[model samples]
Target: MILLQINQVARLFGAEVLFENMQLEIQSQSRIGLVGRNGAGKSTLLKIIAGIESPDKGTLTKTKNLSIGYLAQNSGLNSDTTVWNEMLDAFTAVRQMESRLRELETLISTQEIDSPEGQRVLKEYDQLQHTFVEQNGYSYENEIRSILHGFQFDATFYQQKVQDLSGGQRTRLALAKMLLQKPELLILDEPTNHLDIQTLAWLENYLQNYQGALLIVSHDRYFLDKVVTEIYEIARHKMMHYKGNYSRYLTLKEEQLALDWKAFEKQQGQINKLEDFVARNLARASTTKRAQSRRKQLEKMERMERPQGAEKSANILFKIDKPSGNVVLQLEDGEIGYDKHVLAKNITLDIRRKDAIALVGPNGIGKSTLLKSILKEIPLLKGTLHYGTNVSLGYYDQGQQKLQPQKTILKELWDEHPTTPEVEIRSVLGSFLFSGEDVEKTIGLLSGGEKARVALAKLAMNHENFLILDEPTNHLDIDSKEVLENALIDFEGTILFVSHDRYFINRIATKVIELSPEKSTLYLGDYDYYMEKKQEEAELLALLEQDQVKEKSVSAGKQSFQQTKEQQKIIRQLQRKIGQLEENLEQIEEEVSQLELQMTQPDNLNNHFALIELQTTIDEKTIQQETLYEEWEKASLELEQLDS
Candidate 1:
């Protein structure tokens, strides 16, 4: 079923038309990704669709009683309520039903069994109870717990006021609440903002199985590829829809652009031929009739507009003036944090020449603090750090604090290199996408993206052999990010940067170092490789824990022969348990299936009591099935460990 339709929609900001005549339809389960460069009006279009803002022209039609949840960029929950209470608000309707059910239960018990009032109360109680079960009233707390855990909020945070949480934590809580609300249509603007890599993975898994439709606007290509099945791109005041994920959309867009250009050129050739014939032959007596006919044909022919090409991207290039030593930097048993509070300890790292390393960890794990310590802006609470001979370092701050707000963009770079000619400085700034009048824009007046470009231009001018960057892709659009990735990939220098962008890390990092509160772990390859290794490590740890438990169960070490027999017996028991759990799950699934079929029967649909009973039974069977599946998985894992 179509949940919403956007027809010939147009929006304007001041005198400028942001977009016009945009058409889109959202079905019940559509997973759409909206992508565009910064200032291309993606968010504006979302607002128009979400009914937060009306279109300047045209109309939006939504299904009757349609529900929509919209999360704007960096918009966090502002309630003074505790985290648990804030989440409880998502189920207000269910809670109200629960209250009604309790009242009916009281009324039913107090009245005579056969009386009219008693019968009415009983019926009301039954119907409300069924709805309560259907709405997951019994399991909603579990659902809340699951989502909160996925967002990295533990039980300890349950009583914490929402207003007291950090900005990023509040943003995560807002998203968690939205997911629990489960609106018919979810419109998110940069939902991935302020999320760590681990939280991002959890969100991707949750959204992939979301019951409602999704309309997401994000610059995280990796996320778009994971969660969305279709791409809607806005560019040049036009919206184009592509039927694929982000990566596939790129390929399909390129192919379509090629086809569009070919068709345009073919039409242009015909137009030229027709004009030439009309102009040359209109004056000739023999061909005058033919020329007039051609002219008439030309006037009636429909012309194709020129196909749009690639948008302008920042021209970023990183170069090294001199080579660094083979061993660029080293830290031994470092503890990083502020003042006397050490956030992480036992950190050690080795940076080699030409290595592109990615630093990653959970939020507040001190990834940035470690970088600052390396730059000497702060001292490491403990341990020795050394820089290799002939190493020249350049740093990119995530906050862009190094930029002087009073200076103009032109002077930002030019002042650093007074010996260079003004034209040359302007040229470098132009490469970073600052041109002509843009060069004179004050640093304070520029947007985050503009400041990033200016900082990068200055970094490139330094020509350092080693670069340390923090969240370098924070404010960049997709195009600008790709350009920066390409530049860093080709740079003849060593790099160690911190970013949550998995795609960027995959494209640029040769090594990945994951920080933990206790120690740092290194992976030999890019983001995907690191994930694979982490999964393997987790499995190994699980198996080791199982072994420890098994060892504790034994009274003493037995002879080799006896131990072998005992181990075989344990494996056989695990296999039997696994089989039993599987059978239980299958039986529960069959029961749920039967209940679902009963729900569709006309007899049950027409009878409120029968329908409610069937729904309640179905919910019970589903819970049982989930429990069985969990047991089955655990038993299967144990059996596999024993066999291995």
Candidate 2:
């Protein structure tokens, strides 16, 4: 059940080899995570597998009728249609089936009943219906709704044109459509780029149950651990496999590197001993034969190459020249936004010295806006912000807006602090992995990760006691992110930053502030602790809701019992009244019968007055009987209604 197999795969860019002789197999339902540093050709390898790019030398085999869906980093949907319509396009086959079924239905209606033509049309319609159902045509819209909701695209966005959406929104839509496509093999490159923590969690759960094979390229370690079962590490121009999640892979890789280094050291020692013996004994006549033997052995031995270590990561260090006051920053009832529109209100924060606070919220909820407001780059709609005495601030824009596009990497750092010597500047740049010609490269030409490094190098040079950063780990690789986290953890300055990297936050943050459109809530610990507290709050809310429901049920039960009792009492009264009416009716009937018999007698017939009196009495009895019968009917009807 192998979906794809790549053998002897090699890719080259000019004279530089990105990777060579790489081997990999993607079996049915495999969950693989492909990880490497930036510019390591992880995306290129995905393109090769997806047939978007061909390898310089390799053989790629796939099972017949294999299907693949590839989503590149920042890839977006360019459709002009509305979001709902674009999603419906994923079910083109089902839509076609529906069309054919409709046509067949019309044809059947026009033909004679029970005729051969009509029967043929009906049969075709039945077949089409079966196919539609098998393809999930009936619930396809529901499926789309579920995916849209998971991606945070609500009903308000359904009718919005795709062309009007942002790049991140478009990327989300692309992913949503691909999920609906349900290809046999799915490949995603940095799919978590635009997703928040909630959506990321939802996607992790969704992919865990996905029936198709998945090959994901992402720097999100937490995401890889949750979704992928295997790791394919592209390092040192070769592919290596590990049979576990990202965390497990790190442990295994460290162990393997240690073993490799030991073996290499042992081989080097043996070679050195042999060479020394040959050098000392070659000229001596008695040991000449032994020396020749040793020389031959040395030449025939297989030499072990030194094991390559992990790729070089940026060396980030944050230091402050002076200490800040105990209260670094205080905001009272702060409101942040642009123009008159407020993104968040009722925000109050007290940041102390040496505190590392992580700001987290859904996308577009204004975490970045809050940072800008604190920096005074944007006017606050309301409230006041106070900075402590002697607090020098350093800001790192995740967008890298502070770095001039026209300046070179070296100049970007040099211009910030011209007093520093050229050699010292170069040394600082080298620490950030910018060396030789790399320092000459312009900021505009650099990749996201490279730009981030240059920005960090500048931040390092600034001796500020307080740092405010926004999405600082956006494009950083896992190794670089770890280095940055370590530096921030060691920094003596107070920090307030916004980030969606849960792992980074968990490592470096001492406090977390969750922002919403309405207000902000503070948590007294790291990302894990914050999540635990939020989960507890949710459980408590659920219990409260359950209690409310139980209370309502109990109250309703009491009300129903009282109503039933009242109805029973009314029913009993009606039954007694009906019995009394029936007895009165019997008495009236007997009196009437006696009156008729007396009237028939000869004596009574002779006297007109007596006859009249008898007739009047009979009439009175008849009227009474009619009244009793009406009353009994009414009582019986009421009793029956109560019983019912």
Off by over 4 Å in 2: 103-130, 273-297, 549-644
Q: Write the per-residue lDDT of candidate 2 for residues 1-644, one digit (tens) a residue.
A: 89999999999989999999889999998999999988888999999999999999989999998989999999999998999999999999998886775566557557774788766765666556556656775457758878998999976799999999999999999999999999999999999999998999899999999999999999999899999999999988899999999999999999999999999999999899989999999999999999999999999998988898888878888889999999999999999888888889989899999999999999998888888888898988999999998899999998998889999999998987899999999999999999898999999999999999998999999979999989889989988999998999999999999888888888988999999877899999999999999999999878975564322212234447778777667866886788789888888778876876675576764543454466568658767876786688688878756553
User: How many clashes (backbone N, Cα, C below 3 Å) per candidate?
Assistant: 0, 0
Please list the Cα RMSD from the true structure of every candidate, rounded to 1 decimal place: 6.3, 20.6
- True-vs-predicted CA distance for residue 88, candidate 2, Å: 0.2
My TM-score estimates for the predictions, one after another, are 0.86, 0.82
Error of 1 at 86 (Å): 0.9
lDDT of each: 0.89, 0.88
Over 1-644, each residue of candidate 1 has an lDDT whose tens digit, in order, gives: 99999988888879998888798999999999999999899988999888888889988998999999999999999999999999999999998986786566456557885888877776676567667767777567769989998999976799999999999899999999999999999999999999999999999999999999999999999999999999999988888999999999999999999999999999999999999999999999999999999999999999898998899888988888889889999999999998799899989999999999999999999999999999999999999999998999999999999899999999888889999999999889889989999999999998888899999999999999999999999989999999999999999999999999999999999999999987898899999999999999889878975564433333345548688778878976886787788788678767766776676576765565565466567667767866776677677777766654
